[model samples]
Target: MAATVAQPTHMTRAKHWNEEVENAYRFQLAGWRDQVEYTGHKGEVTTWPNGLIKKLMRKSDECWYYFNKTRECADKDINKCKLYTY
Candidate 1:
């Protein structure tokens, strides 16, 4: 007789972002870039873009502020932005 194998009843799934979440983040980044260009002083114009880019890269991982409160709407859906999705 062949031995029978049992499969686990529960499975873990990975979360991912849908098009909406992606577009929101992209729009936020673009707005930040625009702000870097429009708000910086004349002397700081050349350097501010680099600084803003670094800041955006670093802060992009922050869940609370990344989507700028849009996370709430995405909270209910796994395909939307969530803890690990970003």
Candidate 2:
């Protein structure tokens, strides 16, 4: 039997820049709702030594989206990213 994948039950637009927002920004930028959905599609994710995501392969094109250890979401993008809660 195939394993079941986890998914988000709730989502909301991010209002500030924090750890959670940073994670959501990366997943959303790669065209997903959050890590749960990303992992559901990609299997697993890569992360940096600091525990931040290192990169993500976009499902639509299979291209990679690399992330810095620091924040990547700009002031303009903060409001555009949707944070998910399960």
Candidate 3:
């Protein structure tokens, strides 16, 4: 999981996808996703700032879902750039 630091794109630049990044991707259990703050959530409500991959996925997912709910226009360019964490 050690990739060279390439140019930053849709995916946030991780310092380097190492063991630490992999472990963070796994947050104990399914409920770990709840830790990420969305539109209507309490506590430390915040976007998925866990890492580059998570951040990209979360943002894109949120945008997509929001558009679905509110019928907003989606960003064609960004939407085209799918996150490839695995």
Candidate 4:
């Protein structure tokens, strides 16, 4: 869809996801474009109206992860987004 700048593949998703986790509470996040710049990362950076990284691990919708891109560390740690509860 033109609305979306890039469609991250399974691999990209995994890579980005890991990096995001590694830099959990970080604030300045390296957007997907930064990861696989050769691919559509650039496009995603430009086209995406709002730069929002879906911090998901267990693969569940309606989950809102509170990640501090500035701190480079997830507030609740990877897979510990402040979205849902058990």
Candidate 5:
């Protein structure tokens, strides 16, 4: 006779921050920095450095996790924003 093995029947889901929450955290930190706007012959333009985004993401473990997850999701989906590659 063959021995019988027990199989697990229940599974639990892990909790994670959604894109909206992640974006909210990013935008909150981004708002703290002053944006530099320039008006050249072409037209008005605005830009910010990636350093600011990195700094904000590193502020706390939660922030970093959300940022990292965002990047990972973005890698698979083209619709997601690719803010920090690292």
Candidate 6:
């Protein structure tokens, strides 16, 4: 049997800059709803030395979206991101 994956209980829009918000932005930019969805389609995610996402391949056309070690989600994007919590 396959392992059971827990779905997020609720989601909220990001109002500040944080790791969760940053990750949400990356996944959204890569055209995925979230990491769970990304992993379902792409398997695994790669990260930088400091634990930030290094890159993500877009599922739409197999293009890649690279990210810097620093935070990529700025103040402007905080409001645009939705964070899921289990």
Among these predictions, the greatest lDDT belongs to: 6
Candidate 5, residues 1-86, lDDT tens digits: the string is 22332333442321344543344344334332111110111122222343222333322332332233223223223333222211
Output the better candidate (2/4) by TM-score. Answer: 2
Per-candidate clashes, comma-separated: 0, 0, 0, 19, 0, 0
What is the full ranking by lDDT, best candidate first? 6, 2, 1, 4, 5, 3
TM-scores for all candidates?
0.20, 0.84, 0.19, 0.22, 0.21, 0.85
Encode model 1's per-residue lDDT on 32-55: one tens digit a residue. Answer: 323232233111222222222222
Quote model 1's TM-score.
0.20
Off by over 4 Å in 4: 1-7, 11-20, 23-28, 38-71, 75-77, 80-86
Off by over 4 Å in 1: 1-16, 32-86
Which residue pairs overlap in candidate 3's backbone?
Answer: none
Q: Which lDDT tens digits does candidate 4 get at residues 2-64?
A: 233443343322223444445322222332223233123223222112333434221133233
**Which lDDT tens digits does candidate 3 get at residues 1-86?**
22332332333323434433332332211122322322123223223343322321233332321111121222332232222231
Our model 4 lands, by Cα RMSD against the true structure, at 11.5
User: Model 3: what TM-score?
Assistant: 0.19
CA lDDT scores, all candidates in order: 0.32, 0.83, 0.28, 0.31, 0.29, 0.86
Better of 1 and 4 by lDDT: 1
Clashing pairs in 1: none
lDDT of 3 at 38: 24
RMSD values for the candidates in order, in angstroms, are 18.4, 2.1, 14.6, 11.5, 20.9, 2.7
* Model 3 misplaced regions, further than 4 Å: 1-15, 33-86
